[model samples]
Target: MAVRHRLIRTSPRSVWAVLADGTRYAEWVVGTASSRPVRGHWPELGSAIGFEVRLGPVSLSNETVVRRCEPGEALELEAKAGPLGTARISIELRPWGDQCLVLVDEHPLRGAGGTLHNVAVEALIQIRHRTMLARLAKICETEAAEAEQRRPLGQVVSPHPDEGGPRA
Candidate 1:
């Protein structure tokens, strides 16, 4: 398994707001160039998103299904990448100080990826997870900042116990 964690300077609900938006899938997910809802309501178990991954001149279509969802807490997905088979990706959100600690756990479940799973593959996954988690944090922080800006300067918004202070 490839596991990684990131501290996002946003409340769990703020982080979840990004995750719950199906249209933002490509913005944070590594390698995904674009994403669209394919079936059902996104974030709901069994709902799916179709995404395209581009590598130079080649573009591949992949589909990911929501395997499990716990509002504001967790989401688990199964991503199918053609001959690469499928991978299980589980994301958990934990409240820490006023912020959200996001944990990602991923593993190859089937296909060539599963058969070839090894330490080298895990190392690559770790690298990818690092980038993905950073992107997610950036997106969440940016969105939260934008939302805060929309509010009046003196209007206080309740801070999440985990998020600490204002994000920079």
Candidate 2:
């Protein structure tokens, strides 16, 4: 498994807003070039999103289903990547002061990816997770900034009061 965490300068609700949007799936998920809603409602258990991956001139479509959701706390998904098989991706949101600590855990579940899982594969997944988490943070920050701008003056934006410091 590959696991990584990022400190998002936003509330968990703000972070979850992005995760709940099916259109934004490709924006932060590694390897996906585009995403669209496929079945059920996004972020709900059993909901699915269709994603396209482009490699040079070749493109492939993959489907991902939401396996579990815990509102602002957690989301787990299973993605089927054609010949490469499937992977389980889980995201956990922890309150850190006034901000959110987002943790991502990913592992291969089926097909060649599961069969060939190793240190090298884990290293690659780590790299992907690093990029994905950074992207997620960026998206959350942008949304948070927009949300702050929309708030009335003197309003406490985040639910957590101590969100101004770095997260562990």
Best by lDDT: 1
Considering every candidate listed, which one attains the maximal TM-score?
Answer: 1
Clashes by residue pair, model 2: 97-162, 97-163, 98-162, 98-163
Query: Could you estimate the TM-score for every candidate?
Result: 0.92, 0.90
lDDT of 1 by residue, 1-168 (tens): 999999999889989988998888899898999999999999999999999999999999989999999999999999999999999999999999889999999999989999999999999999999999999999899988899889776766657435654443
Evaluate residue 33 in candidate 1 and report its C-alpha lDDT on the 0 to 100 scale.
96
Residue 61 of model 1, lDDT score: 94
Colliding pairs, model 1: 96-162, 97-161, 97-162, 97-163, 98-161, 98-162, 98-163, 98-164, 99-162, 99-163
- The lDDT of each candidate is 0.92, 0.90
- Relative to the true structure, candidate 1 reaches a TM of 0.92
lDDT of 1 at 37: 95
